[model samples]
Target: MSITSAERRSKDAIKARIKKIVQKRQSRRRCKLSDEELVLLALANSSDQWLMTAQIGEFAMSNSFFQKQAAQFLFGRTSLHASPQGIGSLPSRIESYLRTYGIPVHSKVDDENNKVYSMTAGAAYALLEGSYKKRSKATEKKLTTCPLLEIPIEIRMKIYHLVLKVSGFRLLVGTQSLSVYDDKITTWESRSQDALKMPPLNNFLALLSVNKQVYNEAMPEFYHENHFQFRDMGSMKNFLHNIGSERRKHMRNVSVSYYNLSAAAAGARLLAESDTLQKLTLTISATKDPAGHFTVNSSRRRFSSLTQIPGFSSMKRLRGVQQLVFNPRLEHDVVDAFLRPIITAPKPSKLSRKKKSNKRKRKHSELMSNHEAGQPAVKVSKIG
Candidate 1:
């Protein structure tokens, strides 16, 4: 029997609602059952919590899901297996998706192997929060997934602290170039690349210079461990002048190796005023004593002796000094001269002592009068 026009319209509306509901459910499942789900599934199947990627892959191959455009690929090879394709391409595809969400996948070099994929805390959050559907389709530009760019500055700083906790202190020392968040491109050659290569620290600093947000976030990281490796005098002077007005609090650790006494002096001057500098490692390459004068060989002012500079006497400005390592070959006298202010006892404050004595006398007289009169007197003392 043929259906009536009104009945057909009613049927179509019901079918549409059902389809929408199904789509929503599938999307939720896809988001919830991530590659991490593969591990759970593996445990259920083999009663083993620790299994290799290969084992997980084998388990994914056994559990089949009917194809739907609702992000089924997230649970490993379901989407790929559904297509009219072989399973060989599944590893690379999974790797790509994992990387897009900032997951760390282990790999070996020489033989060029991308190994088991593991989730970072950031990646796990990204996976949970990531939307599977294409929201804006007008332009196909690469989408930025970093929450750092989207969140408010206050929240971003908290997030940065979280990132630091996850990445650790060694992160600053690992590489200067590798950014915490960056775009990914799929190239034929790079698809098989063993390790991801990033720009040098200088290049990363240059990138930070381009935008205010990047500059604000990156400046501390850029100067966290300042290093001035100089080959000549001109570059050394220029570097010192450039960083003269910069906030010294960020210069926590500094390393300077200079070619001559002048360069070393310039470096020393820059570091002397650094209020927050805690650890300093200095290496002087010049044979001449630090006290020796370098003539005005160039247009810049040449100092006859570094001992005359106020900055040399003001090394105590770095009140947070913890570790000081100097090259053994460096002159003890020169190092001593630089470090004397830090090591020597501070001069007694005549003004402070006089004021304290007057106050003490007044207190003593008050206390004697209080004792004779049977009244209470208060005492003040400094607490360390």
Candidate 2:
């Protein structure tokens, strides 16, 4: 085991070099800024920006990568020791350092007597430029993966319909004066009335704007599922025109209110053009007297004119017509009597043929009886 002095010196040198490298690495690790320090630096650099210690702790905790560093800063060997009484030991230590650095601190006592800390103007600026911006970008990147877009198209459409479809009819009314469209003098009055209040459609519009493919899938579900109500023919016409022909094909149920026959006729004509419309609920406003009979002369006249209007007459031509509901306020039997001829199939002429057959049988029986009685043969004249 005996060694030369030169050999011993060489071995000693190697050991000393290794020890130095280990010491350097330890020093570097110890000197590294803790999460609390980074947060303080961030708050200090933000001029006039205030933050509570709890908020800082929350931020550090939420970013799990910084959790250990924050713990080390709060309770490590270099941290301050304070009494466990009054205002909390941890916060007291933090406050002492903030004061030592001459970093202006604002303290507010809450209802529970807990102190909240905030940075004032005198805190030293230590955070590097773009640090906050980088953090914000990182957070935003984490939120960009939307689960909604990942779902199957059929499921997404169902969800969209659930969200966008109205529970009942959606009323579309005009807020301005009405005007003629296509040179027709429609009975739909001035459109300058307050429309019925409705739930917001902004969410549906926002969903549609997500992308072109999403818009294509959701638009049909939104239009096809809900029943649309229009105050008059003019408003319905405007709505149809605005939605364009492509979307119009998805429209199915429509409810319209008309003050006059002309308006009803006009609305019917417009609805007749919609190839997809299956149900039409026509609401006619007819004022009644104390006896429950229609009181307005104009109303009676308009009701009679319903059958005469070209648009009203053409309702039979609507291939998709299924249900027609008149306002329940009017007499159902009376209305049915009038509309039965217009909308129902014509009856067969079986009653007239049965009556003629019975008469011929009666005449033959009488002639047989007379012949059996031995009466002279009476000449029977042919009845036309």
Candidate 3:
């Protein structure tokens, strides 16, 4: 949820009004408010409905010196001590004066046996309805900046996960990087559980564009956690290439079903090198003309084109988690051959590059010696 500029202006106006009332009421009480005005001001401004003396006092103390004058007015000194009488009597005095002025206070005992106070509904509504007397030093506002990066990394990751996780649906990303809409064609596709939990794709993706630090931290939480579905292989290639090859390492679960073969080769080339890809599903749509039939030569050519994409070499390797589904009409034997997984096994250390280099150096030295001695140089076989 977000506040519009108009909503923010309204909230600021309400705060200004409340501050004005607090100042006017303080003047009415002849500058001996015993902390009533300050307590009212704090309660009105707080996001929390109910707050204790310690919470209110902490709020007041953290504010400007002008605000702290209430505590001094109550304690008859600059600083307050934790005497039983000092802390205990302050809220009672504040509550007593506030009630007499018809600005109601709702009091309840917290688990700690201390008073938790909030404004009554009527008083709160009345505060918002009134007009502020005038703008002055008392109503000056301070802008607060959030220290997002200062938060602990573990906590930040939890926040990122909570905000970014989308389950039970695939993000239908197109050439625009994303395209979500209602289609009368499908029943359950419209009410996607996981995607709805997130903001609109554009809004959610804007989180990545915030700054380098936020982008670095949140990018993985989004890309790695969600299953992305593409309209065609071209969009998939565009998304991966535009985000950069380094970020493509996070491409885990992805699906693409395409009628056109234009993007097949480029998309496959990216996937071949994108060693981090865990799960992939590729569904090749049946290609045909408006008449819904293909000539023998055309069908053969079409099958040949599909096999060339990502090529047998790259496909025989793998995208770990992505399940590639080929056209049922296509040859299962050829498709199965391509989809077969393979991992490169390291060669024996004895056949390492250092030994190969040394062998070449030795052969060159021997040939030089034989030539100098006017003898024929023996041919050396190439190292396997």
The best candidate in terms of lDDT: 3
Choose 1 or 2, whichever is better by lDDT.
2
| Candidate 1 residue-wise lDDT, 61-83, digit = tens | 55543222222443333554443
Q: How do these models rank on lDDT, best leading? A: 3, 2, 1
- Per-residue error for 159 in candidate 1, Å, reads 8.0
Off by over 4 Å in 2: 1-149, 175-198, 260-266, 285-307, 331-384
How much is 92 displaced in model 2, in angstroms? 29
Q: What is the overall TM-score of model 2 with all chains considered together? A: 0.40
* Alpha carbon lDDT at 299, candidate 2: 47
Choose the strongest candidate by TM-score. 3
Candidate 3: regions farther than 4 A off = 1-146, 175-198, 285-333, 343-384
Give per-residue CA lDDT, model 2, range 1-384, as digits (tens). Answer: 676898666545544543333233234334334344555543543324455555555554454445456555544533323222221345767777667755556667766776666653233322222334455577687667556779997799788988777654443445353221211212133133334445456745688877677788888877777767666666776677777777877877676665444454555555656666666666554443455454222444433333553345656545544555666654444444544455433322468658888888987888888889987657778999
Deviation in Å, model 3, residue 370 alpha carbon: 17
RMSD of 2: 23.9
Per-residue alpha-carbon lDDT of model 3 for 210-296, expressed as tens digits?
A: 568887899888877876777666777777788777777777776666434556567666766665566665554334445543222
Candidate 2 C-alpha error for residue 227, in Å: 1.9
Which 10-residue span in candidate 3 carries the lowest summed lDDT?
182-191
Better of 2 and 3 by TM-score: 3
TM, every model: 0.33, 0.40, 0.43
